[model samples]
Target: MQSFRERLQAFNKCVCDGARLMVGQGDYGTYVAHIAKTHPDQAPMTEREFFRNRENARFGVGNSSGFRCC
Candidate 1:
């Protein structure tokens, strides 16, 4: 089984790629707002804000190992 770090890395990569595509497709604002609402901690941010938050490592993507309501 993959470790938490591995899972987090995969998730982050996917999100990053998705965000980039959205921005390139001219849906930056929409994508950012949608992610902010759906996944607040992983919400899209400006490049500056992204670097600042990333440097601080201050965000959570929720605990995915456990089951939740459907």
Candidate 2:
């Protein structure tokens, strides 16, 4: 059985993740885990690179299509 402290920590983590999702923020931890699981041979991007890439992808930055989502 899990101790109270352990259970509380886990619940807190879930709440935090849910909050981030509700705010449309990507979780860096989830990205890292996905890369590790699906692309074991490739290194995951640094957090800064990940966020920059996500932002560019979201807003169509540096794309010739010339469309911005926001």
Question: Which has the greatest lDDT?
Answer: 2
Q: What global local distance difference test value does model 1 have?
A: 0.60
lDDT of 2 by residue, 1-70 (tens): 9999999999999999898666545789899999999999999999999888777777788899876875
Mark the regions of model 1 whose C-alpha exceeds 4 Å error after superposition: 25-70
lDDT of model number 2: 0.84
Instruction: For candidate 2, give the lDDT of residue 12.
Output: 99
Worst 10 residues of 1 by lDDT: 54-63
Query: In candidate 2, what residue range of length 10 has the lowest lDDT sum?
Result: 17-26
Where model 2 places Cα greater than 4 Å from the true spot, the runs are 55-70
- The true-versus-predicted C-alpha distance at residue 35 of model 2, in Å, is 0.8
